[model samples]
Target: MDEPKIKNMEEFAAVSGISRPTISKYFNDPDSVRKSTRRKIEAALDRFDYRPNMYAMNQNRRLTKNIGVVVPYLADPFFAEIARIIENHVLSAGYRPVLLGSHGDPDLEIDNLENLRLIKPAGVLLAPLGRVSDAERLAAFCADVPTVLFDANIEDLGAAFVGSDNDQSIGLIVEYLCRTGAPPAFFEIRNPVNPNANKRRAAYIKSIEALGHKPHLLQADGEGWEFEQIGFSEGTRIIQEHDLPTDTILCSNDRLAIGLLSAAYQAGLRVGLGDGCALRVAGHDDHPFSRYTCPTLTTVSQDYAAIAQKSAETLFALIDSSKHFDSREETLFNGRLVMRGSA
Candidate 1:
């Protein structure tokens, strides 16, 4: 037999013989109500199979339990992985997580913030699209909401920022490459969309210069988030033209390094640290696929778990306090050097 469908809380309240406020109180926290009232609500729940319209109820409240988690380029495994962790934390903390992707679009990023605002979320955890983000819009949104930035940061955009220390990660790889092989030449996109790329590039130059080796930059002309394609295309050109200044290459990130590895295989150039291997390659971010590459990739591993946990905790604290932080906070977790066969 088909059961009755209670479409609204008011209808459920009527059917359950409980006042709307009491039902709401139960949903918010059952223990807040008297023991007898709690048993009545439980009995009604089991009998009617009634599900509260949480969104509608929350909308009427000053602050909703929703926590927005926005990430750039969710299709990328790195971002996807971090988003999953953040979602789990939000859930475990008794808050609802609303996950959204900017899809590497600045306008879409702004639209996401606008939508989140309408939800009256208790707080938000955002991984902004650094270089291409509409800073003015982002800053305005942050001012209105308790937001914590992560992954990539825009200056003064949120109550706090959490990300990897690109300088440390890049320098670690540079020093390792120089120690075991020829000083690495930098491989990166011509116009990087992510702010981390710029940091890594500068770190590479600084590290190489400090070690008394001149930095050689091999820039590939490309844009957008298709890093692997750009890496492969530019790597092939470099290999075919024999334009590499050094036998070792340090890619801006693992996605690019993966593409470069593919190019090397296609161009008949062996990539590894052992004898007979013509080129040594390393990358950053320790992308999920890095470990499965033909020779595995030597890269810097971002503290994904730490970044996600800290970002979530920071946002929750801000939400609970219902006030802006005294000062903007910035936390950058260090990356670990993951040595593999490719280096």
Candidate 2:
């Protein structure tokens, strides 16, 4: 046996009688080329292990396999889990995933975007810090790089957005809690970090009013992604000092509900549907840790897999097309009703 001499796409292209650009095109999308050309390239690939260096590839051309995945906070398991799903899909589709955490800091988010631009990634998936993000800078970055928004979205900033259906999820949980017991109070951060919370809040108010009940909207004081701490502190104060107008509480997200649960436990309050329990608790997002809570949590489950898959697929399409198409794509996956002991 003899060692193959082909070292790069240029060498392979020279030996296979295919143009370098055509080979690059083939690598970008095998289906982009004619069937005969694809067969010839396949033959060459079988004969040698010559592959293009990803760094050199990007340097050589305007595009590369590199993809940037930016999130507001990766330490939160909700974002972490979703990132993992998107990463797996991106890798399987032959694109390199670069995970960047904004750490809930706006300055760091802009800095991350700047750094990602230096890499000239084929595309980017962003989970921006809503309201806190520099919109002008994000718009400029999206102009330079094809970007998809997930988790949190800013209107017209990204090529597309994939997120949970806030109205459906929140409405569903609120209705369930109302049906089982007294109408629930909407417990959420006063100044939400994500746009979904605003939508959820609006939906709760509308749903309660429509059902002929006045909503008890409890404004929890908190900041950043430390939702548990905010929920716990506010919930403790509310549970101890204030008389709750409703017997049931529906949190905007599960992390906050977890804190409220802790508060309730400390306050000697029972949560569940069984006899003698004082409160019916529910939440949204059905976060990964929701199940492990002492009484477990009843929450609306966002279709995490659907959002991740569609987001990555749409970004790949934009990258492969290499052209910005008209019409902003917005996908809101419906949440499922997860019945757990907490409610």
Candidate 3:
């Protein structure tokens, strides 16, 4: 049967067979009603899929079960994968989900955020553009709209933050590379986009030192999220210039590794852990496309499920309270190493 479109609360009330005032109470908060009333509303909801206008509900200073999820770059498979996970959670929780991408542009990020504010979303799960983001604008937005930060965080912004533990993830890979072959040189962008890059670099240095091995960095130049291009270009340059100090390389993220892989391939340098392989490469994030590369990438996988759930849950809590948290909560989930053919 075709589901009837619910144009307004009146239509919803008529279909639900509940009084407008009572339905209003339920919409305000499901638990506000008696168990019987709650059951009735829920039953109607299941029989005919009807969701209140998120914007209208918010305009009345009442919450709608609407959430906004924004990412720095959606074209990147990593963000696409994570956004999908978050969307499923929002749908299952009976909230409408909206997804937006910044395309690695700060202006677009601010614009997306402003658009979300106009909707007056009950809450938002944001993966900000890190250092490029307008912190003041974001903090002010969060102050008015319940928000949770994930993927990247800004100090003193939002009600809470959730992300990967870069230290643990990078350390895991660095140790593995050292134990198996050579102390890998870290390959990264000279001007990286994500804030997580800095933490991963720190962790790489710490991990190598702790293992009694000297660390090296192959800092490449890049802007925005063109990680692969940067890595590839840099890798090519290093190969031509004979600048590399180590046979093994660990990248800040998979995108850069992808670029580096291309460079190695063009240079006819074999990449793998086996005897005949001339170079061994590893990366972080285990990007969705990582497994499909010519030589499947060996990388650390972020706990996307955990990050999504934690972000959603924290945003909901802030929405329920209708207040910003005085003390911001920071949560970081660890990454698990996945060995592949590459390294």
Best by TM-score: 1
User: Model 2 TM-score?
Assistant: 0.86
In the range 198-276, model 2's lDDT, one tens digit per residue, is: 9999999998888899988899887898999999999999998765888899998899999999999999999988898
> Model 1 clash tally?
0
Indicate the residue-level lDDT of 166 in model 1.
87
Better of 1 and 3 by lDDT: 1
Q: Cα RMSD (Å) per model?
A: 1.5, 3.8, 3.4
For candidate 1, write residues 57-109 as lDDT tens digits: 88898988899999998899999999999999999898899999999899999
Candidate 2 overall lDDT versus native: 0.89
Q: Candidate 1: where are CA atoms >4 Å away?
A: 34-43
Best by lDDT: 1
Off by over 4 Å in 3: 1-54
Provide the clashing-pair count of each candidate structure: 0, 0, 0
Error of 3 at 222 (Å): 1.3
In TM-score terms, candidate 3 sits at 0.88
Which segments of model 2 are wrong by more than 4 Å? 1-53
